[model samples]
Target: MVFFNKVGKVALGSRLRLMTAIITDDAAKVYELYEADFMPKWFPVFYTLTEEREITITEIANEIGHSQPSVSKIVQEMITAGLVNDNLKTTDKRRNIVALTEKGLILSKKIKLQCIDVEAAVESLISESNHNLWAALEEWEFLLEQKSLFKRVNEQKKMRESQDVQIIEYTPEYQEAFKALNEEWISTYFEMEEADYKALDNPKEYILDKGGKILVALYKNEPVGVCALIKMNDENYDFEMAKMAVSPKAQGKSIGWLLGEAIVKNAKELGASKLYLESNTILKPAINLYHKLGFEKVSGLATPYKRCNIQMELIIK
Candidate 1:
């Protein structure tokens, strides 16, 4: 109890396992009292086969929400116990179909009567509890399905890490960082094009001085990411999002997302109606990040960079 209290929510899996063990042990005792030779773990598969008459291993897994391998193992155990038969499909010999045997059918019929009393007993047990554990479990299952624990934890982690990150406007001191960050990613994937050097080598002269903005992300007071909102005189777009890069060490800190978001917000503040971007599909993560930032695929606009094979735009207005 002391350990669980100290660990708090971190012991969720342990608590769930303890609850499952208690319920499973009671089920085993019930089967023993009825003189039934069955394992509590087999109930889900057995019930599914009895209802479906015949189903493939994959189908059983889908129906019971268990992994195919787990369902296959349970089916094999039932087959060994002479309670089920595993047959290959006539049309597709590679596929297996499971069905209850005569022994299984007889046992299922006996269990049907047991289920009536068991359901009532479980309902009474629930009524005895302060809260409806069954309903709470259903809600927990739905919420977990909506967004997994992995994603939820990672979101919290990003939020915590992002607190250490600070987004600031372009300054002369960060000129080298802006150039190096973009050059690192560009050189890693493709050769730095003439247009890349023109803009990266002199961001202030080429971007900021010409009614544009550059945003820098500093992680723990170190420049880790940079992006630019290059103002454009195009009829469709007011700015072109360019030179976005996150240092490899700070990749998972959500700096890229924060920079993109800051760029968008800045563009809107500057009375920009739409933002444009150019990239190659080969850079999947960058393309995905653009999409997440509300950028949609667009064409008909020529680009100076040889590496630009795709173009996307975001409508801020």
Candidate 2:
């Protein structure tokens, strides 16, 4: 998300158009959209699915066009809220088939019906007062508009938002870049130790070995953020998140939140029910970010890493 200054000789009048305006949609709204637009109403007809019949995370993921892990995480939430259940499985029982609970079935039906009415009401408004509706919105945007302050803040945020960070499988060429990230955090923030070459074990390998994933956030040549999923527990849908570290240079740039969101989305893709994180109280902002992103605290200790002074877990599904 580097900003470039262009050399130009214009006669004091130049206007630059933005490529794309940012769309800020929070997790809850996204969840609501997913629940309202799809689910029982659509799924029943689309896939011949029903609350009574057995279902699998893979099937739902396919229907939703989302990663399997991400879909699993959502299913876990449904299960936790008693909207879904482990009602059936193959003879081995290792192959679990998810099913909707009574609550989920009822809630989806209610929402589907209510939103239908809401949309009808909105349509009536449009049919009755089209001009006033749009004009009111336009006047609101105009009245709410501030000058450079808003633009400056948004531009500053863009310094991190539109970065080209992506998921890459670990490789030797990437190994150095990986170790560079590790070496950057060698002792203090990166797992209490550091090494090079032979002793340098890239953390992503460990995470990958656990049926999870690794996603690296890159800014052109430099790696800025890294998150990994490590297998943790078998209870409450198993596996916890570990080895989440962002570059010091990228602090306050939303790198952590991006990584956090990535982990959640990735967890859902992986079919996880819950996500737990361990951190120290020293990282207040990190804790706040976790809370903002929907992680909650627990009474008893919940992590193996003693260095993790505070542990926060989120039921992803």
Candidate 3:
């Protein structure tokens, strides 16, 4: 179709809205044909009133999965149409209870009859179509609940932007870039401890010379992120993934993720069994990224940094 060919999949919201308008327009005509004065937007609220003889505005909103203000507006519209009443107070006297008027009860009989035909007609339409749109809609709702479209699109955006990033091993010329990146993030969150300075100031002696490895992420030939795998002689864990930092300018480009992933792959190639990491709960985004990289919380470990309140481990082997 020209619509899809022109706008592509990004027009999905507009397409769905157009189809919904068409369906609701048909619904309004059906109500008119039955001589039941009703608006299509009022069906959800009206149907809930028939099921619950008396309900508060908040209760109606919960039942219909709508905003409280929206339900209140609908209630006011129904009240003006002389089809509903909301003058009674709840037992607590804090909320107004709503119910259908005598005129609404008469119109309910007509709507019930109209619904029977509408259901059959909808079923027939579905059976004749190539897709089971009802089931598909339910599945779409379920998937969206699991992961929203916003997060999904952001993931895609990050992945695309990260393609421009290049992960490279440590080089002498890039030492300042690595130090400045780590210091920027550390000083922003917490004061740098002696252990941080020992590692950052002398990576060659403290990390690389001690059998550790550092990786740098370069975007457009400029260093944007850094991560190090400090070799550990522990019986359980083989390496401590530490000092991960990304430039603020490159925050949303997945530079941290790419640097962390490179460190993991570097560890696996070095015959490491597990990778340990220490972080603070205050860095929620970093903690979430660690979890996404398969790190699980673990206890019973000693740390040098006061900011290290949480420990996590990833088993590679």
Q: Model 2, 236-271: lDDT tens per residue?
A: 645666556677886656777777788788788878
Query: Candidate 3: misplaced stretches above 4 Å?
Result: 233-237
For this target, which candidate reaches the highest TM-score against the unseen true structure? 3
Model 1 ranges off by over 4 Å: 88-95
- The alpha-carbon deviation from the true structure for residue 22 of candidate 2, after best TM-score superposition, in angstroms, is 37
Steric collisions counted per model:
0, 10, 0
TM-score of every prediction relative to native: 0.90, 0.46, 0.93
**Which digits, one per residue and each the tens of the lDDT, describe model 1 over residues 1-317?**
78789999999999889888998999999998787899999999999988988789998999899999999899999999999998845578777878999999999987888899899998998999999988998999999999999999999999999999999998999999999999999999999988998898888789989999999999999999999999888999999999999999998889999999999999999999899999999999888989999999999998998899999999996
Could you tell me how far off, in angstroms, the CA of residue 314 lies in candidate 1 after the best superposition? Answer: 2.9
> What range of 10 consecutive residues in model 2 has the weakest lDDT sum?
15-24
Total clashes for model 2: 10
**Which is better, 1 or 2, measured by TM-score?**
1
lDDT of 2: 0.61
- Model 3 clashing-pair count: 0
The pairs that clash in candidate 1 are none
